[model samples]
Target chain A: MAAEAVLAEAGYAGFTIEQVARRAGAGKPTIYRWWSGKPALLIEIYARQPLDLSGTDTGSLEGDLVAALGRLLAFWRDTPAGEAFTALLVEAQHDHAALEMLRAFLAERSFPLAELFDRAARRGELATDFDLAAGLDLVSGYVWARLLTRRLEDDSRSLSSAARLIARGCLRR
Target chain B: MAAEAVLAEAGYAGFTIEQVARRAGAGKPTIYRWWSGKPALLIEIYARQPLDLSGTDTGSLEGDLVAALGRLLAFWRDTPAGEAFTALLVEAQHDHAALEMLRAFLAERSFPLAELFDRAARRGELATDFDLAAGLDLVSGYVWARLLTRRLEDDSRSLSSAARLIARGCLRR
Candidate 1:
């Protein structure tokens, strides 16, 4: 928890194992023994954080998508943990280990959304041949693009609109 | 040119005015007088390079989008300039001036796509209320997400699929 806080505040450039150990009141050896390094520690911290996807089922595909995306936007806009996760993504570009951990983290995060798609299909809301992976990529991609380009703010209007468009596009005729 | 080459090979971390000066056979003062800093220099180099969008007019929206995105993917995958541009994006996160430059670059790049959307609207292919900005964001966002996450390789299958999907979604029946 202290490490997560430090990561959020310090960013990748400022995050150091020493500071984390000091803040957590743990010995260097204790931290190192349990985790390989910062990437491993960050992954552990990220995995422990709760991602609320239980409310993703809203009966209608459109409602479910908007709610799921709305929650994701809220997490990014409202939480320090979200900032930490972004810092890790940037770090992943140069660090292979971090890239692996980040990929694993992303896959785990996407599972719930995949399940949501499955529910939509079962409800006869989705086309039989719809590409779920591609659809999810578009949904998540729009959010990431805005966030990375600094285009995202407190506004959820665009998020909802994009979700609606995507839902409409992917629905069964 | 030297600065661009240096940026491509050495990346932002290894790039410096000094190295660029030596490579260019120019003095530090000359480089300093013309450009304020690395970010400014990078922006200049990026702007000077040509981005071909002339042939983006393929008549059909799907054809144009696929062509435009295909060119973009080629730039990122095949050119050193693309590598330089990506390094600039990473640098933008830490530098305010760089962020401004990156935003400007992105805006400039989006203009041609906007023109394509205008053509689509004039052709009565798009819904009157279709959000061009949001649509473009989804298109560019998907490409960028894949690029940043290292999930993109030589495959343009997903790009074409997304383009077709977006085109279908935005079209007025």
Candidate 2:
């Protein structure tokens, strides 16, 4: 909690273990005993956030993708956790340890959406041989591109359009 | 040129106008007169790079995309200019001016590729109603995602795969 507060107030550059220790009223050794370093502590804070990955079936892959993406967009726009996540991602670029931690976090976060693709395949909604991972990359990549560029407005139009395109690409031939 | 060397050597965090002025043997005021700040100088450096956007026709959109993306990947990996560009992108997060400069830079760089899409539509290879801008976002977004995440290997496999997917998505009904 103290870490999150520090991260919010000071951002990635100003966030230091010492500051967190001071804010939390805990000794440096105690903090280190629980987490290896800043990246690890940040990961712990991120993992504790309430991310609702409970996807909607909607009886079609397109619906599932739109819903999933909508939730993702909302998560980023409506939550402090989202800002923390972006901060972590930005920090990760400068630190290899943070990059590794962020990679693991992203993989875990993407699991539920992977299941949506799996379900689509089972229902014969997806093409006979869709590259599920690549599809995920395109979908998520578009969202991330918009987010990083500050083009992601609080509307679902772009997300809906992206989902439609991806669905068409993945549809059964 | 001096700014680029300094950027490569010191990275975004270490990059400063004073250091660049010192390295270039130019007064800080002169540098400021030529360019508003570090971000402006970096964007100028990037815009001056010889990015060959002359995509090959190869009689197919997929081929055009693969060739363009291959050249892009090479430009990033083979040149120090790539490091400067990455540094600029990273720095853009903290500076509103840098972010604005980056957005303009990206738009200009993407123009030739938009023309490629236009050509494909004229050839009846793509849907008449294809969303050229959205399509561009998806294609470029996938490439950027791979590059930013460091998943872009030297091989052309990912580029080829992404091009194929985009081509399919843009095909006329």
Candidate 3:
């Protein structure tokens, strides 16, 4: 993880397998043995690698989404992790395997959020007919916007504000 | 545009600029001169591109979002364009120019949607504190879920259902 951090901070142009090996205190050949190259290693590092969603949830659906999304943005804002992942994600847009990996990542996490909406519906917290899928999309869509467009450094307020709107509007149906 | 059509139909490994020129009814040199390469050309096609949202309105917020999303997704499912753009978009994850171009394309479209929500707010249709950002994100996120997950084609009904859900839910507030 530390090695991934260093690489993300430096970028591919400045990346070195030997450095990752050094940072992880592992053998260089060991790193090489598991992966074909830097891109592969980068993808591995990006893989559902643990995101802390502890701060998410605040009683109300909107408040919960706000907390959850804020954590998500914070996860992407890591010094090396965010930038490297962004670049790799851009690269995945072209590479078949990378795109697959990216999809896997989204599927693993995005579904959980969709469930959140579904639960909200069942509880009568939201309209029973509310589209859980759309709710998920709305939240995911905002993240995608930040990643592909602004590439902004996520702050607590931005996530909360976005959550507020989604809660206020999308859940009403 | 034709070049994009061709490339999207064929993977980059199998794609040829000459073929794109022929498909586009333009000469190879002319295409090459403008793009200087394949990646460049791919980005240019989507650059400043627009997703027509004229028919999205359906009186209610959820209805409007569904109609708009349905219209936008129509291109992804029924046309060669979606397949082609996906191929190129997958690649953009790795290529710098591709990332920049796609970001620009997304921003161009997102702004209009954001304004749509704002207009709804002004009309007293939406909660004053609605998350416009989340609304915009949901619109694109559904498409991304399909494209990135490769489920858009296999599950066309899912899109419509999602649309229905959003249409009813988004306007509730």
Candidate 4:
């Protein structure tokens, strides 16, 4: 909670353990004892944000992807999670340890897409040789590009177009 | 040249006009007069990197995309331009002017894709209703994601899969 306030108020540039400790009325060593560094604290704070996708399944890959992407973008746009993520990415660029942490975090968070893809496969909708990783990369890449560029608006048209492409490409003929 | 050297040696974090000036054996005011700031200098340096797609058009949308993506990834991995770009994106998050500069630079650099798309249209390979910006966004997003995650290695399989998805999605069915 204190870390969230610190990031929201001061941004990543000023998110120091000392500042977080001061805000939480705790000692610096106590905070350090719990979290190894800024990236670790940032990740924990980000993981607390909800990534609800319970209603994204629409019985079609395109439909599911459109709903999924829309919800994901909204989550990033409307929460401190977005700032926390961008901060983590920037830190990863500068720090090797942070980079590893980010990759691991990302690898562990693929459950949502895995569920969607599994559903698609069960329905015989996916191509026999559909590359799941490739689809994930394309979709996530589009989201990251929009987020990094601060263009995370409700552009349903583009979202639909992207979903259609992936569906058609990955769908069984 | 001095800017490129500075970026290579010191990276974005250590990159400063004063440092560049020192490296170039020139005055800071002279450097400032030539380029407004680090972002401008970075953009200019990045633009100098060759984005040569000379032989990418293989008479098929998928072929062209595969070649183009491969070349682009190689370009990023083999040059200081990649560092300049990641630096620009990181800087954009913290500074408004850098964001605008990055947008402008990206807009100006769309010519390569435009040429490819136009050729596809002429060849009757593209769907009449294909959304150019959406396709571009998907492809470029994939590239940006790979670059930022430090996975710009040659993965022809993923590249081919992505191209197939776009081609099938955008093809005139």
Candidate 5:
């Protein structure tokens, strides 16, 4: 929580262990005992945020994707999750280690998404030749762009439109 | 050119009029006369880079989208364009004015993309209810995610796959 507070106030440049420790009224060694460093701390803070991906089992992939995007956009817009993730991405741009950590975090987060696609396949909704990774990339990429560009406020019309496109793309003809 | 060379070498933090002038053997005043500051200079240099969207006229929307993405990914991968744009994004993260410029630049860049979609409609390839702006966002967002994550090296297999999904989504059912 102190780390998040510090990150929110000072951004990547000002997010020092000393600052977080100062804010939390805890000793530096105590913070270090829990996490290795800044990137680790950031990840831990971010990972705690709930991404309600439970809607994946919904009847159709298009419905599933739109629901997922709806929850995701709202989560990013209404919570600290968006700020924390944006900080992580900005940090990744400058620090190689942070970039690796961010990539790994993103890859790990894809499991639920992968399941969504797998369920679609089981229902015979997805095209036989669909590349799972590429489809996932487009969906995630769309969300990341909205997050970074601060356009998440546009909401359902745009999202459902996007979902329609992705669904059609991955759908069995 | 000097600005790009400076940016490529030192990145956003070190990109300044003084450095660009020194790199070019020109005076700071001359550089000032040419451009307002770092963000403007970065945009100018980037705008000069050719993004060949002429392939839009290709008969099939899928073919056109694939060719456009192929050229875009290559342009971002092989030239200083990627570095300049990335630096712009990083700068935008920290500076409000830079962020505004980046937003405007991105909006301006969407023209050719709109044309690509409009051409698809003329060809009777796209869905009647398709949202052109949302469709553009997905394609550009996919490319941006690949660039920002340093995954541009994966080449045609991934890009053509992405193109296929986007094209299918927009296709008339």
Candidate 6:
């Protein structure tokens, strides 16, 4: 946790193995004994933390979305973990190798939700012909949009609003 | 035209003024004189071939978005400009100065469509407060998700689906 905290504060440009070792109150050998280098350390921090993707599943997609968005906003606003994730995400946008890892991570992490959309669609929670990829893109894309603009703090409510709007369409006629 | 085409073909990191000059049979100084550098040059070309965001107002937000997204997809699919834009955007994520420019450019170029949402909202078309910021995030985030993943071939149907789902509030009601 200490090592993770330090990396979040100091980006890759400023990150070093020694600083992590010093902050964690562990020897350099201890740090090195685990992570081979910077990227490895970043990846470990990313995995070590728990990210909440849970939603209420209120039988209505809209309700589930609203609850999930609250969770996302709560996590994004109050936690160092969220900031660290965003910081690392932002950092990866600059580095190609990091970007690849970031891409892989996003895809892998998001697969379950993709399956969820499929399940919802199969059970008539969504349109028969709805594009799951695009649906996911819209939800996640909106989140990233708020992030890039530094307007996430002021725009939290919109998350649930967006969720409600889309969920209506997916409901049975 | 040839020089512009070359920039579209080669991208920012892959492009050079001399190569364009040679390809276009134009003086290097002419390009350098009009555009200060490669970035400026790319911006000029990207702007010249702007995606048409206009379409018949289909009354519903979903309908209007479909029209707009259709145009954007047509542009992205039929042209090379999207590749150049993607390259510039990904590179800009890591660059401080370029990031500012990207935000400013999006503000100026992308926000004109608030009228689309405003039209719906004015007619009491939305269920709750629409988060333009969040909606924008989802829309752009999808593009970025693909770009970051190196999936540039993905169509604008994703955006169309996103705009529709977001307007309906699939996750937040």
Scored by TM-score, the top model is 4
> CAPRI band of model 2?
medium
What interface RMSD does every candidate have?
1.8, 1.8, 4.0, 1.1, 1.5, 4.3
TM-score of chain A of 3: 0.72
Better model by lDDT, 3 or 5? 5
Tell me the spans in candidate 4 whose CA falls farther than 4 Å from its real position: none
Clashing pairs in 2: none
Model 1 per-residue lDDT at B66: 83
Local accuracy of candidate 6 as per-residue lDDT tens digits, A1-173:
76677755764345677899989999899988987656567766666666566545666666666666566556655554454555556446446776677677677767646755655666677766576766666666556655544454645456665675556645554
Instruction: Compute the DockQ of candidate 1.
Output: 0.56
What TM-score against the true fold does each predicted structure earn? 0.89, 0.92, 0.69, 0.97, 0.91, 0.64
Ranked candidates (DockQ, high to low): 4, 5, 2, 1, 6, 3
Model 5 spans > 4 angstroms off: A25-34, B21-34
TM-score (chain A only) for the predictions, listed in order: 0.88, 0.89, 0.72, 0.96, 0.91, 0.76
lDDT for B155 in candidate 3 is 47
Error of 2 at A165 (Å): 1.2
Candidate 5 C-alpha lDDT tens digits along A85-141: 877787776688988998999999889888889989999999989999888999999
Better of 2 and 4 by lDDT: 4
lDDT (tens digit, per residue) of candidate 2 on A56-171: 88888888988888877777666556556666767676677878887887788788788989888889987775787778788878877776776646656666767777887788
Candidate 2 per-residue lDDT over residues B90-129, each given as its tens digit: 7776678888988988888788789888878778898766
Query: Between candidates 3 and 4, which one is better according to lDDT?
Result: 4
Model 4 local distance difference test score: 0.89
**Tens-place lDDT digits, model 5, residues B1-173:** 78888977886667788999999999999999988777899898888888787845678888888888888878888877887887777777667798899899999988988888888888889888898888988998898888888877747888889889999999988
lDDT of each: 0.77, 0.77, 0.63, 0.89, 0.85, 0.62
What are the DockQ scores of the candidates, in order? 0.56, 0.56, 0.29, 0.75, 0.65, 0.34
TM-score of chain B of each: 0.88, 0.91, 0.72, 0.96, 0.90, 0.77
